[model samples]
Target: MKNKYNLLLSLMVFLFSACSTKDEVNIPSDVTNLRAEARAGSIMLRWDNPSDLNFLYVPVQFKNPLTGAIIKTNVSYLTDSLLIDDILAKDGEYTFEIYTVGEGGERGGNTLQVSCTALPRTPVVTEHAEKIDFQVSALSANASDPTEGNLANLIDGDLKTHYHTNWHEKIPFPQWIQFDLKEPVEGVKFVSWNRNGSNNANAEEVYITGSNDGENWVEIGRILPDELPTTGGAKFESKMFYKQDMTFTKIRYNAKSGVGGKAWFSIAELEWYKTWVVVVDPERN
Candidate 1:
């Protein structure tokens, strides 16, 4: 009877220890250093590793503030960062939560709460009309003759052909090509393609000026060879948005020199963006 009592006591002790171990293994410690950064169209989440080794996975939850919809993701313990993209939330505040899943599927307390806002989308624009019939002038050049080099070539939209100034006939510095947009534009952006030749002759400095009339021009944008590579491909330049969109009927491009001292200012193609406003007629409707 004494031996049997000792054996029974040993079995009870082992059972109690097993249960205690299981309980301890199923509880997870909290995660630390959770952070979220708002980007152009997404949010980046980062965090430090959990102190406890009992966690099996980390589950992140995103909530839509307007629709009350939920998005859930499960990540392994090894993942310390994640980027959530294409979130169709409007320009407003949103929240997210993180929780740690223990070995036995038990979830620990909430680790962190994060809030961020989506940025406003940029406006869409399309190609506008190019002024092909405009006056061309420089300090001196052969721009008058259509057969040789003319201002119309700038807006011809043909990359194979370009407008080249007569460098041998006159000095190439401080050349300009001006045109009438015919109609006023709400806003404008410019793109220029350099002449693609053996030497890759391109503009070293270009200035964009706008005016309501043919005279009294105002500088709206500037492009340098450093900012816009004057070789290989076309260079795109954008104008800064003003307090209110301005209207301009005349646009001019003034060139100072050629990239790498190529002796002339040559442009293959020039394009511009114009904001168009649509008018609805109530009588026709």
Candidate 2:
């Protein structure tokens, strides 16, 4: 019988070679129109590649929903876009995944999850108030008294001009005065007045210092003459208030001793105050 027709043609060629090796895999074609964008520490992805031609590459995966930590990458199907910044700006959301990879690494059709959110690392303050000016050699009297001495007449917001420091030649006993707040300044509030009447070259052992490079000085308040106040004219006013907001750019009014035993030291007015904090970063817009 021709060997039973050659064993039925060899079992029909072994059932067509087991159905062609079980359909030889080949799933691949899912990666199109996915998008995301949540900046401010980063998160930006986009996609649309898989016209299949055996596409080949686009595996990206990133999940760190609080440390399940897993981050892989491979997006080059001609790059659609991706920029996930290392995660963690107080982290609260992140889990992106893409698919479609053929050329044998076959993994396609459905896997494009996305959910990102990051934009708030805190930053947006603004305040402003100013009053600090006295420039012109930035005054720095160590001994004035050239006839109503002019250390810019003690900041010129005048209270009847006065500021005599060198009684014709006598500069002993810690006599000082400095200025230059050209910049740097923190919550400082100082005010002064004296020399409007007879307090005998007033300005007793007062000490109010601050510096940001005039050689490290930092006291910031002190007064004497019995803390001023003697019945009106606000008693030779003085009001230092630096609640420790240190950040001076320079301001020194030393005067260790004066008041009758006078070696020279007086003032009519001087003022200072600054408050300008502006920090904004609401995702840069």
Candidate 3:
């Protein structure tokens, strides 16, 4: 009986140890940048496809970004990407769970939970910050689709998808693209780039402007070389500041500025930004 008791105790200890042992779970460390763009009353959620992941069944959750309460019914797709209508989200904290769905729907995600709330989407600048949640810049390869050339979302590095719905015959030189910010913008960042280490007919120039509506525009900044160099296309960002509380909504840049009268550019990207840090002046005696 003594021997049996000892054996039972040992078995219990072994089982507890096994249970306590940290089992390696599939939790992606790479922050999957997610963004929701509100278009025609719908919120499109786009995030990076997890690496080293074969197939993912993500249980995408979203709520009032204000309150921590769980929003219902948004528990939708296990798809590679998710696009849900705004009507589904309550409006506080928008959370997502990527289910590492393997063969037979074997789940392995959300074991280590991660979340970000979706408030009113209001960007208010404080003393330290220009605006709350003012996405300074993002560095994610998956932000834009390589093949389709589409972009989406503001922060969390979701690419705002845009391209010539169809290919052009001439492949228009000095390609130009623009973006429309929903709210009032006071800062514009001209993000433009071209191919690396290959200057053939690659001539690229860039310009910037702002506006109240999406139509009327005005030049706010410009960048050009003193003289056109033999091998140097525009490759940098110019942080432009806007004053007078002017509401801006459009972004336009030279896509493929012709070089030596013959060369079109395959623009890698053009990122735009908006910062509203309003100051209220007080009179002093």
Candidate 4:
């Protein structure tokens, strides 16, 4: 009978010990630094790190507040290593929150809020561009390489374009590359950014030249940014075309200069500026 009692007591002790295991996730700091940047027609989400946690040991999930769309991914050491690009947002209010994934987890992560004017202004083709068989070839350089590229290298120039060759290289200037529109208008009126150089003085250069027949360029204007490269090499997508109707063919954008001070300039797309709000008929609302 004493043996039986001891065995029962031992079982109770074992069960209690099993239920009291130390939590594997030690959330020292959480408050995901979520940031939202609006560019072109897309909005980018930059979130803080849940990274230091175990890789395969624990999985993370991202949920969309509107659609409830959930994405499962692993959290490593890289911060904001994930991007949400499903953009169906209109001009309104939106909010998103992040919750930590536990081992069958509990809520302890980060949350952030941002407001955006998710609208874009596209230009009305005054004259439909007659497609020309033109291809642009770009050549570039840094403090390390200095031979800049051309329209063919930056963008396919055969389409009806608005700018031509624009090249601007200077001291204390960001390294850049550009696509010159063959047509001429005003100047670079819009300023949006994606992946810029590595510093606050955004190391990107944009200059202008004027031409009529897509050849014979002349320097006219430029836009030098004041930003830097991402500390992490994240893919940046930004656009800063034009807003008011101007005239110029030869527009140039240079990025990632040999110039130092945390700068790099990368562009995925560039377009001509057109007014975002257009009234077809003033009398009709």
Candidate 5:
């Protein structure tokens, strides 16, 4: 009876030990569908969480291609995305690796790896039209009406209004409008919008010129007007020109002709831009 009692006690101890070992052995699930995106100065990473309930967190590793510096981050299981910002480095490829961890601290067998390139930082470009003043050579008149063709309409940000050359007095070719940017800029870009709806008065020959003091101007770019009339009902035509880097405070548009020889030049809107650059560092501001 004593030996039988001892055998039963040993059996109970062995069963309890087996159950505890099974509970402590955690199996981690691998993360899936890892994706990466490149922004202006950062990279965004995303991945699908493991379906296993034992998932606790993810360990992410990033390596700088140039310096080989490794960065490690522990992400909560609840989040599926992360943004690594302010990566200030020369344009080059970078690498990433991800490992999933289980509740019991077990790492997944499979590791996710990805690569992305950092583009060189360039100057930011911003619109500078609102700070400037403008003037036109002539204002078009309709049946002795003068309110429809003011030069201010060009920069009012309204496509419905327009600046038109004087048609009542037969304004000659080479009609022009100019803007004073208030300060000189390193470079400039122009986005010009033609009259909307069916009007044959859109400028056909457009010339962009720039000057420092509004006197001796230099030709920057030109757009020859389309000779053929558009078949669709009058729609606004937009054109863009990127000028070389130079110091200029004034920009001028010289229109030589109108679509279908309408003997008038009209502009619906205009936008101006200036460029700038930024430097970045991953470890510092």
Candidate 6:
């Protein structure tokens, strides 16, 4: 009888220990140094993650500024930053609430809260007040067709002629045409015409870069393949609107490849214009 009683006591103690362990829960610690930074049409949130091993994820809650919808997102514990994009510019501010979640679905007691106003959106150009022609001081190119079409033909104002890259021999692509403006021109956009009779030789990938001293250049604009003119004898006027004007004296046009996978390309004419516009601030209105 004594042995049986001892065995029953041992079994009861094991059962009690298992029940206590299964019911245990761990609550996560709160994030630290949480902050929000405002950007144009977007808001950036960053924080330092908690060192607690039980931390599994974070929940970010906000109301859409453009639409009256509740936004809730789950972020991995390993991530410490988030970018909320496509937010509309408004007179009111946005509020954000963030908290941590633990492995056992326990919520952290502390929640971080912040309010921020995003930067103003880029204003649309209601009208082009003026387009002043800018003079090119010099012209250069990496490769030209040996048989016909000289570099001088690019600015000669003749639609019948063109400037063609080497066709007799294969020239590795990224063929370029560069020009220097007599002086720095601000708020500039360019117009380029394709070869008069054919579009097959037009560049598919185009990038326009600008430099003040002609040594170091920064990308000012890019022309997508669909944006390039598909029909022959057509013109492509850059539609990229700059929020802040860029002033430069030198401009380079790089052709990564020609249409239909050809190595050579052609341009009929190139022109630059100084644009003028007036934007009324929404707050002032």
Task: State which candidate has the highest lDDT.
Answer: 6
Query: Which residue pairs of candidate 2 clash?
Result: none
Per-model TM-score versus the true fold: 0.51, 0.35, 0.35, 0.33, 0.47, 0.52
Considering every candidate listed, which one attains the maximal TM-score? 6
Q: Which residue pairs in model 6 clash with each other? A: none
| Local distance difference test values of all predictions, in order | 0.66, 0.73, 0.46, 0.41, 0.69, 0.80
Model 6 regions more than 4 Å off:
1-137, 241-246
RMSD of each: 8.5, 14.6, 22.8, 18.7, 8.1, 14.4
Poorest stretch of ten by lDDT in candidate 4: 157-166
Residue range 136-158, candidate 1, lDDT tens digits:
33112323323547666666667
The better candidate by TM-score, 1 or 6, is 6
lDDT of 4 by residue, 116-160 (tens): 433343333332222212234422233222332233332432222
Q: Model 2, residue 9: displacement in angstroms?
A: 21
- Model 6 per-residue lDDT tens digits across residues 1-285: 999999999999999999988777666888988899998878899999866645889899998666768999999998999998766567458899999998888899899998888887676555462443434348777887887648778888898888899999999988988887776755557788988878788999888888888788887777888889967779888864342557777777889889999989988988767555767655444
* Superposition TM-score, candidate 4 onto the true structure: 0.33
Residue 230 of model 2, lDDT score: 34
Look at candidate 4 and tell me the lDDT of residue 269: 26
Which should have the higher TM-score, number 1 or number 2?
A: 1
To one decimal, what is the Cα RMSD in angstroms of model 4 from the true structure? 18.7
- Residue 283's lDDT within candidate 5 is 34
Ranking by TM-score: 6, 1, 5, 3, 2, 4
Q: Give the per-residue Cα lDDT of candidate 2 at 231.
A: 28
Which scores better on TM-score, 4 or 6? 6
**In model 4, which regions exceed 4 Å deviation?**
19-31, 54-83, 86-91, 102-115, 119-285
